[model samples]
Target: MKHLFTPYTLKSLELKNRVVMPPMCQYAVSSKDGIVNDWHYNHYVSRAIGGAGLIIIEMTDVEPNGRTTDFDLGLWSDDQIAPLKRIIDACHQYGAKVGIQIAHAGRKAEDADIPVAPSAIPYDENSKMPHALTTEETKEMVEKFRLAAERAIKAGVDTIELHAAHGYLIHQFQSAFTNKRTDEYGRDLALFGKQVIRAVKGVMPAQMPLIVRISAREYVDGGYGIDESIAFSKEYKDAGVDLIHVSSGGEGPILAHGKPGTHAAYQVPLARDIKQALKVPVIAVGRLDEPVLANSVIGNEEADLVAVGRGMLRNPYWALEAATALGKETEIPGVYGAGFSLKK
Candidate 1:
């Protein structure tokens, strides 16, 4: 099998290949309700049929207020389940495993009525200050993750990923720069991360795979960085996370820089470092647009999985095109089935 086509087993599921469609925001869903429309299903199903091993749907907010943007998707309520189910079912039919990235955008929620965080901190000077969550509210957030996981399971996704990275709510709690409260959730820098892990543990079944997406580096003074993130992963492995989706911080264009450079696999080390220390699966992502670059990471064992975001966004047939570059045939999702009339 090709390196990218090699099977990867995470917890209970075996991905048919190593190519992963990372969680990317399409901003398709409107804020009016929780349901993901046809746009989402078509968007992901295209990649699924294009032969990506795993397609991690973009962050599905655990609550309406937890959404990062008005168009963000949600798994907070039952109504949203059917749309996700359609996406998952479509992916599975094409022999691709589907995963849902569930999150609480927290302070990142724009124009939120009840902006929440471990402490009251402004997301940015121009951004509105969030309301520091009460103890009861914090516990509810944990359960919200639980309910979200439950909904994900009901939607038939193969795995559930907790979004604890980015400068969102969970990241806010993990970073000492953002979380500065005296309370239990605030007393420790790692406290907020633990809450997310606990929430994942509570809601997911032992048989279901659990992954955590974290910003390995904050790229800001006093913000969480690679070392701190490795420690966070070690603790997560101890707490039973199946994979670490190592992403960089969600800093705006102001601080956009990687550990090495903005070349392919620039952020591979975060996943590599965490895997070496934790002895678990690490997913490397970021501008990995070339087949050779992706093969290099997996062949040399720099990381276990490669998540392609914009590359796949620009060309849903990227995986197939990549496979062809490595001397293999291609398969495009059937929704575009007619478009591939020549191939068939």
Candidate 2:
């Protein structure tokens, strides 16, 4: 039976274990230049050291204004490559494959002078109204994703994740609540995501996988849900997406169907649904901090991988501890092993 410690292989990608540290924004970039610094290096490298099989870097914007904040990582410039390369190289040294979540914040870009989205919709009443992208500019945005993928390949990422979740640029385009355009984009909600995926894949190595994160169940009244998400997941898989990182909400929370419960493995069902619907691998995330619960998802064959978010943030050594708890054989650094019971 598969467990969290089982080595997972997708195409040419071989993970030492199934523990994935999903992209959690560090907001540690020292300048608006979007160049990674010591904090990012230390942050990601620590997780790799802690024994995460895949350390997916945070929502790295494809363009400056696409950022949720000025502090988020960016791949728009060649200068940003080396700093990110530094992190990827360090993670590789620790036997962890590193992937980057290339994204655009769109209407949710809190720090932009004026955020842009599929339409001129404000994320919420408190948020600033965003400028709508012209059809030509929308094409330009797709090119930006392609360029970002090229830079990520240059930085030597083992894989690349397109951030389409949490009310970000791509999600804004996918969710009907945020996108109210009269163009081809709004008519076909999956069009933008497909274009971006195709664009990113064009520059990526054939063996490398592309993961797309999606909010499978948006809480708002008119937002997309599991069925719609499944339909789009199929479209994405057809467009070269190798995996789907299942997440929920972020489209201006309405919670009319009731908010998602704050329980362990809350989003595993979403992942499972997509996997079953598309026969595609999925990374189950959201409050899967417990070792047993995380392992259960894999053991039950519900998901291909498990992503630990806040749990990892609070304890960089979560994976190491999980290994010890589950009695899974792992190379815990000698220095850290002393902290675990030596009786075993």
Candidate 3:
């Protein structure tokens, strides 16, 4: 009977419902320093108002140079804390749990043409070929990630997610296709990911949970695969990560297999495989827009949690509405309740 509306808990934080707001970039907010603005607050507030159970804030960069766009959110400075506090408080008021994803874009940082990466490679044709991070500079990134996690804690966020995948910084170290150096930090992909986790935990409260978003499969030849991903997930679990949000086929803009044209649950298999490998829970996210699809996945134990992306953007109150359509006991907002119909 477990469906999309089931209550899930990780660590000490309890989610009111199962729907999660996956981190999707909103590039219109800021350019240089990544200051949180009305556009940022209102965008997330609207989603919370739509009735998501847990609201994971967008990829908020841990360093200024970590930005992927001129207008991405940044938590590198203390000044950024208050603006985030507002968003966190708003989500809390709506009975939704809030978690901030602190990230470092590495070679993907968009502001400057000269960015840092494990090796000198471009994420894409438009991407800049980055310089390798020196030993001291690499250590600096560790501190930046740690301080960002600490700031998120101070902002009263329920959880902190390290952006380790999706062609970002930790991803640079995690993927061998882009990271070709012979140093301990380069070829040993697991070590760099471990350091990021260790450093983040060092600054976080003992009670707070840490989540890692990983692209379970590169879906490319000679790239990282599920075996490597699960092995790393085991490390994440042992390193004390509370959950591994299973997603796949990234580290590049377009996959060789063609993602935008793939089947609905193309990525769910990654979650299923990783779930079997590790003791920690897994969250599956792909084209899970239908209630039956989501329910069937969770009900059949394909994944412990389902993340609705484009579907959520298309319908903010999707969880409540889906539960309603499925005949589950869930409330409907007065404004949209009177005439709403699953059939229509």
Candidate 4:
């Protein structure tokens, strides 16, 4: 059986351990150029040096307006390739694979003059009203995703994650609570996500795994729960999604007034359920900061991978610390060797 410190393989990528650093937006881009700066390179490389098995870059938008804010990262242009390549190459040297989460914020785009969604629905009463995308524009957006994946490959990433959760563009199309479209996309809720998966797959190497993050449960009155998410996950799997990163809420302000709990490993049940239901490899996220809890999830076969978000942010060397706490033998890069040596 695998444990937190055990190596795990998915397709051509073999992770040093089951620890994943899920995508968390940095909003560090200045001048709205959507390009990486010194902050991004230092941020990701530190985690690699600190010992994360897989370091997923933040939510990188495929288009300018697709960004949650003008400061988010972007892969929409060729000029944006080299900077990200630097981060990927550095991580590879330290035995940590890197991936990028390509996403479109949809109606939740706080930077756009007017955001776009499956429908014209506003995220909340205080939020800006968004324009409903026309079918043609929707098709164009799929092409955008494909192009972005192509760019990511050029940047030399090992995997690509499609962000369809947190009420983002793809999520907007997937949930009935937010999508009130009268078009075919509305009728086939999973179509947008499926098309994105296919498009991304087309640009990706056959050996490269594609991960899709989804909100397994919505917190609002009309939001989707695990059951509905399971059905959609099956459809996405059939459409070529290799892994699912299970998360919940962000469909609206529902969490503030809805039923989802916010304790340690709160979303593990959702990840476990998706794994059992679809028999697909999954990455469990959400408050899995404590080493014991993260290890137990793997020890119990509850999830194939565990992502430590807040904990990781607080300490770049979280994985190294976790290894020490669990008494698991792991490599600490030559430069940092003396610092983590047991003999010391």
- State the C-alpha lDDT per candidate: 0.81, 0.91, 0.80, 0.93
Error of 3 at 314 (Å): 1.7
Q: Comparing candidate 3 with candidate 4, which one achieves the higher TM-score? A: 4
TM-score per prediction, in order, is 0.92, 0.97, 0.94, 0.97
lDDT of 4 by residue, 86-177 (tens): 98999899999999999999998998998999998899998899999999999999999999999999999999999989889999999999
Better of 1 and 4 by lDDT: 4
Question: For all candidates, what are the clash counts?
Answer: 1, 0, 2, 0
**lDDT tens readout by residue for model 2, 122-155:** 8888899999999999999999999999999999
Q: Give RMSD to native, each candidate.
A: 3.0, 1.2, 2.2, 1.5
Candidate 3 TM-score to native = 0.94
Question: Which portions of model 2 miss their true places by more than 4 Å?
Answer: 342-344
Candidate 2 lDDT trough over 10 residues, lowest sum: 253-262
Q: What stretches of model 1 exceed 4 Å from their correct place?
A: 251-261, 328-344
Error of 4 at 79 (Å): 0.7
